[model samples]
Target: MSKGLREYAIVDIETTGGSAERSRITEIAIAIHNGVEEIERWESLVNPQQPIPPAIFGLTGISDDMVSDAPLFSEIADTIYALLKDRIFVAHNVNFDYSFIKHQLGEAGWQWQAPKLCTVRLARKIKPGLPSYSLGRLCDVLNIRVQYRHRAGGDVTATVALFNLLLAADSEMVFSQMLRKNGVVQRLPANLSQNTFDNLPVTAGVYYFHDRSGKVIYIGKAINIKKRVAGHFSGHNIQAKRQGFLQEIYDISYERCGTELMALLLECLEINRLWPKYNRALKRVEPRFGLVSYTGMDGYQHLSLTKLLKHQTCIQSFYSLREGAAVFRKMISDLGLDIRFCHFPLEVRLPQTANDLVRRIQDLPDQELYNGKVAAAVELAKADTSSYFIVDRGRDEQEKSCIWIENGKFYGMGYIPSESQSNSWADYKSELQRHHGNEYMMQLIESFLAKSNSRHQVITIDAEQLDEAAILKPVELRMKML
Candidate 1:
């Protein structure tokens, strides 16, 4: 061994459990070597901020009481990152140690990455046909003594010796093949080539992860496509689901949506269309429930959370039950709607209603505004009688984006030159190229209408004042649509 040999951070970490996503690291130790000799050492008892299970307590002897005063991983993240920054990360089970550190550093707003060297793999190739490769057993076979077996300081100290021996013993090319892969490769599915990975675009857009047969397995949106896609393979804290996802990805593809808003819209559409293997796999935390309104036998329109008939249209749908309840509570306060008439479930009921329950459910200021303006936008689109306008900010400032709905169907989204911003509706439509829009676009627009309260929003146009209709204002660029 000499000074010219590459530096390695021979590392070990003990954790509350296996998965980096769900579990926490309790201890870490690093023994840095210049591929020649151990240069320095660092160790920490990390406060995992989680309850250590009784079994883990017995196994590592790292108790909650012992770690009560220790600094959290966040506190020591900078020091750990500096040590492992440029050197290859060496570990007995490199994936486990590397991934735990990577995820912990990520939580602390740092990126952890390095080339990997698994001493376990190295030992098997160097020694050949060992009876047992476990660190304790292997050290015993080779006459190397290790203290403090389950603790990071002891295990990493043991690994440093094991690593040097294997490097000295590598008479064949096994170690060179192992060195061919960088840390990122360890998480990439075997079927994807480094060349394909290098070719990913760095623009803001939507990306698709595909299986070997070319079927989409996952869909994602990112402001920087390359960085985000690179992150998908950043760690190997391989949970079963994540491992399966990696095994399935054969290639990657993407669509460059010039605007983040467009990218967001497209991501929602693609997820709804493909419903890929990995996307939306977790149960939704926010409620996807809604309340619908119908006219009952008493001639009063009733609102209820239960599923209703086809003709019973929804007043509003919310992302969470709590959001729906808030809106209902506001309705009772403003519209003087009765608590019983609110028709919400028991969990949503307020303990005490406003003493004066005035049932003025009709002709409210909001109701009048929606009826006059918002309803006009829908009716204009629905009647398909005349050209309607939905103007939006373009991909960039030099142009503007517009949506035209003819006959209550998505006509297309097209661009207008900023120079011609004041062009009439007919002129704008004349320059519009025929483009594709889908069911998602319709819903996207519907949602927009529910949320908006702009004055210049054009539901229908005056035949003579066409030029004014085309200039999309910055204020009108927002969507309050439902």
Candidate 2:
């Protein structure tokens, strides 16, 4: 080994499952290289102390029977640690292998941390424009051969060869640049470019991560676009979905917003529109159950819990059937309404007094009076449905952002010049961009308004104001009124 030459521990491991936290390593291989030639080669089959799933056994051809007599990872922990210590951990999709070893080593009472080099990322950087970067495809492209496909020993051999090729082709010293301490380029997705990340603004915005074919895979909103994007790649989460997501990120695009509220709104809209694969949180935020009213054949008004139906209005919405039922039962109890007139789903366990109330249908109030009470409760629930506008800072100092809520729903939002004299809500509506609103968007606005320190100002607009062209006071005056 020559002085000043970087050392690498080329590694590969077969695991019982995809998650490092849940899975155990079944086999491991390490090839010690002094940035020139292999100094040592080591391999082992380990008793993972768990049954190997059939799928994994079939893939690696290493069944539980084979590892039954093998040594546990604890027995070889010291040797593995010594081999990897002070060497750059190199592997195909390196984080997956590194996470497993690092976790299992910790379980064995050894804390190990090392710089890592991913051959897949190196090939994309040094040998650009390859159709695929998977180990098998790369071998086929580079004329490298392997005796066993999924086994650690065989995969590590091919990875070493690929690393050598990348080293020879890396005339731009991408390796050195990536290895620098706290380099953002090293943490970025293998397919994403440094320039794309470098160009990200520190302002509030929504960002989109697209795959190689330009299909959006994920969408997120951040106060600082670059900082938040970096967070996605910061942790070594060896979960299969996260690993796969990082690999698919090939490009990034962003839309800057004046406020975090605007970024959040845009994020929700885009996630719903694009239906990106990695966006699961916002999509599931919509309420699933609603409280509805209908007239019975007996000339009585009835309230029921029903699944949210498109084009049908609800007195109130809830995320779960139980939640909607709870509120419905409270309303009925408070109004002293007949339990028989309210429809409860089969899943709901009625209160102990429900049977007693059902027998009191003969004692029910007059039809007109009972219906009037129901109508009053409906009106109370609808009180928060009034139209309003939220005014805040815009993308730049010269403008201000306006969010219009019509009849208690998010109508749209847009920026207006700071000096614009238009004060009519009707004029503001024409200037803003229209968007379909959902329960989640409404929740965001409601939560924002509830914050006592919020800088935004709210202006209430009545239906009569829309008809009469009523003028809205300036935002500063509105703040004073609040």
Candidate 3:
């Protein structure tokens, strides 16, 4: 190849398995092209030095017996590096091949880096709107015959032909633009389209990544949808799971939220509802400890710290045993109740006078007085569970967003118009979308409310106010100013 002439090395390899870190190449083929025609070609079978899995042998038809006498990658690394040193690397799903070769080369003491062009992405740009872009399906659609289907040599030949077609049909100079160092197109996954990425909105929203079968694989919340999605593809991570995740993403869809808080709430709800494969953070989360009330044989209502139990109501739920114990200790201290009746986790530290208190419990005669104090404490603990609305900025200027907490549980959230004239809570409830709430959702709301600088306003309402005609009068006036 002469200087100043654009050259590409169309390459293909048959590997032992899908992961580059865990698999090795068994066969390789390369076709060198200088803009218009092939200048050189090379093909070889490599002794991977590892047993090929039966599945890979079935796919490529290259068994251990066939590669017994072949050259190891170390023996041919120099030749392979020389041929691809300064040329653009082209392949179907380029990253998969690139990662395998790059990892092997580094192991052989040759660090290599080159520009890559994925024919799958190029075809999508050049041809526009093909139903499927898998090598076999695409060739069948275009009437380009592929022989020796999964073998390296035959796949390289078919790829060369595909590259030629893409070059000829690329009237918009997309190839040249993608070759630029700063182009995002070069970093995107082969199955994802530039148009789909470009269409992501720069606003707070919940985004979904769908696989080829249109099943949601991941769900996330973002303050800026475009920037956050772009971050997922920005790194050069070669882990098998990360690589597989990138390849699985074939489409993206998003739902815009009025505020970051609303986006977070929606993300939690959808993740729980859909149980997407890539969502692991919130799925396993729940309150770990609870403060429950039990009636002992002595006819006294007792307060105790216990592990979260199903089918039993808790006076308060906490994320940690220490937190629950601290609250329980304070309630006992404030109500002047005997500590002997209260059960605590083994890790909890009791006060210095606990032994004396336990001895005195056997002599106590008035159970009614102690029961009254326990009941009063329980009522105080439930006082925080008031029905309220968290009002915040809406998606636009025409409305405001409201998150409803019914009797201290998240009911739902939605946007209400600035000029609404509804008078009762029933009318407001009809405007909101309902969602199932969990302990994690309550924790999020509580944390947000605890923030001293939070801009959202809280509107507390009692059961009696739900039927009043003037319940929303003040809230309506507040919405207009928002």
The models' CA-based lDDT, in order, is 0.70, 0.84, 0.85
TM-score of each: 0.48, 0.80, 0.83
In terms of lDDT, the best-performing candidate is 3
Model 1, position 272: C-alpha lDDT score: 69
Tell me the tens digit of each residue's lDDT in model 2 across 1-482: 23227789999999998888888999999999888778899999999999999999999999999999999999999999999999988888777888899989998999998887778778887888889989999999989887799999999999888888887777888788778733566667767777788899999999999998999989999999989999999976878778778878989999999989999899999999999998988777867888888899888888888888765678888777866787788888887767777777898987556877645657777999989877887777667658778888899999989999988789999998888887765776798999997888887776667563547777776676667664544442323223
Task: Compute the lDDT for candidate 3.
Answer: 0.85
- C-alpha lDDT of residue 467 in model 2: 72
Model 2, global lDDT: 0.84
Candidate 1 regions off by >4 Å? Answer: 1-4, 7-114, 117-202, 272-275, 280-287, 293-301, 307-319, 322-340, 347-354, 358-398, 404-411, 420-482
Give, for candidate 2, the lowest lDDT window spanning 10 residues. 473-482
Task: Estimate, for each residue in 173-243, the C-alpha lDDT of model 3 and write its tens digit.
Answer: 87877787325777788998788998999999999999999999999999999999989987667678888
* lDDT, residue 444, candidate 3: 78
Could you arrange the candidates by lDDT from highest to lowest?
Answer: 3, 2, 1
1-482 per-residue lDDT for model 1 (tens digits): 33236788899999988777888999999998987789999999999999999999898999999899999999999999999999888887566777778888998999767888777667765786777667899999998899998999999989988987877777776566667755555455544555577788887789999986889989998878989998987645447466446656778999875545456667766776788878873212232556665555644445666533444445555555665677656655654554544477667656266344555655233534433443333233235334466665666778766666655556655567777744345576777655455544555665565565553244454433444555644343333321
User: What's the C-alpha lDDT at position 439 in model 1?
Assistant: 43
Better of 2 and 3 by TM-score: 3
